[model samples]
Target: MAYYKEQFVFDDGKPIPIIIRNYMASDLEGMIELQAKCFPPPFPTDLWWNEKQLQNHVSLFPEGAICVEVEGEIVGSMTGLQVQFDPKNPMHTWEEITDNGYIWNHDPNGNTLYVVDICTSPLYRKLKLGQQMMQAMYQTVVALKLERLVGGGRMPGYHRFADEMTVEQYVQAVVKGDIHDPVVTFLLRCGRMPLALIENYLEDEESHNYALLMEWKNPFHR
Candidate 1:
């Protein structure tokens, strides 16, 4: 596939161009190193996707596994799979959906694009690479004729008030504009609707192991 490109101007007025494209066999090492830099401590090592798991993602959904490159170096990645949107069972934990990134649940004929993970290298965070990756996913969703984008967004800021509020209360607060969560806020800005609060979805102490079940409907889906 051809690389998708976008240009962004920083505070210094210099234009930085980024290329989004499908993951390649040669990008395996860069992807692993970038993944390591994306998560902080207390984020469980066991929950992280290994090379084999990433390989599985690529093998299963080549069109959904995307990488971001700047100046010839891999700086961000977004991985997703196609799955049927079952209205009967709307709520699902991260593990149940992605099978911990082994992607055993992928359905090539499905109408929903279930994004499993989106991360940017630490050095590139200021460049808003994560947001760029999401935009790329949006384009992919439109191209694939998907109906929606579904994923669990980490609530890294929730632990600050964990002693005072349950995950539900916290999510409720965020939904009501009583509080702002970095991840949740960003997802909202990206046009995703927060559907539910998932418990023990990830292994981060800071997030209190909570994640927001977020979905963005594809307007182009017909």
Candidate 2:
């Protein structure tokens, strides 16, 4: 069943139907293609979701594994899992938390929703698909009555300023609007607040192996 649906009318003046729904076994191929298109050359193709991992996502946490579809094609996707979060110790590598993208450690009783990955197709970037996917996740958070939605956002734009400023400074700059980081800025626009800066979160050279811990608290949670 579809979790959410909307129609987007772009410059062409044609309404395009967009659906946010749970992942199905049939979506594996399209998802693999999306990963390649979203993260090209230097992104380590091995990091892409394999058939096994995608299968596990649907089997273990179908509610958390969703995709944005348009005319039967998967244009965007987001994957998440519930985890017992420790605010006191917010430092952890992505692999350690996401189980190297398999999300095999998902805890049904956990209090927080940890976003494993969220990406949009290059062709649909301007359609605000990412934001819509985030909104869908927000709905899931409220429905699940979780404490918050948390994730490590990569600083793909950091490589340019690595020689001039520390990761801390760069994050502050982005928060203050003094600098523009694609990932960090997008998270901020999505209503997420920066929790901390994590080191060795991932092996992305563009991000200098660093990631920004971000969160969006559930307003309805009591």
Candidate 3:
């Protein structure tokens, strides 16, 4: 597949070129750097992508691994894999679903595209690079004739309200627009609907180890 490009203009009207494309072996280092910048110290540094995991992504499903580049630097990325997803049994940990980020369990014939991870450089947050990367994944869904795009979205804002409400209540408040969660809200805005609540989805203290199981069904899938 060919790389996609767009230009974003800054406040001074200087347009910077951005390229969104499938992941390449050479981009692994930059992707790792981006993970550090996006996740920071409190987040486990070990969870960052390593050369082996990135190599697995590119080799196993290159189309599902995408990155955004600005002037030849990797700024944002999204990785996913085809999985045999059972909507009725949607309770799975991030590691279990993503095979500990190696995607070794990728099922070519599976009907669902499971988004494993997505991140953008801290400095490039204003560029909406995440949304663009997601849009590219949506395109992948249609092209692959998948049923939907699914992901376990971290509820980073939940810890702040954990004492005030149950996780379910917190999710309801966010869905009802009564509260705003940086991660969940962003996923909702990307056209994904809440499927369920997953507890102990990962080691995210900010999210109280909780996540919102979200999905975006492909409208073109018949």
- What lDDT tens digits, residue by residue, belong to model 2 across residues 103-141? 999999999999999999998998888888898899999
lDDT of 3 by residue, 1-222 (tens): 444656663524667678889988988888888888988997789878999999999989888999988888898999999998989999999999999999999999999999999999988888788888999999999989999999999998988999989999999999999999999999988999999999899988899999999999999999
Give the alpha carbon lDDT tens digit for every residue of 42-77 in model 1.
666665668888888778888888888888888889
> After TM-score superposition, what is the CA distance of residue 183 in candidate 2 from its true location, in Å?
0.3
Query: Sorted on lDDT, highest at the top, how do the candidates line up?
Result: 2, 3, 1
Which model is ahead, 1 or 3, in terms of TM-score?
A: 3
| True-structure RMSD, every candidate | 2.2, 1.6, 1.6
RMSD of 3: 1.6
TM-score of 1: 0.89
Q: Mark the regions of model 2 whose C-alpha exceeds 4 Å error after superposition.
A: 9-14
Which ten-residue region of model 3 has the weakest summed lDDT? 2-11
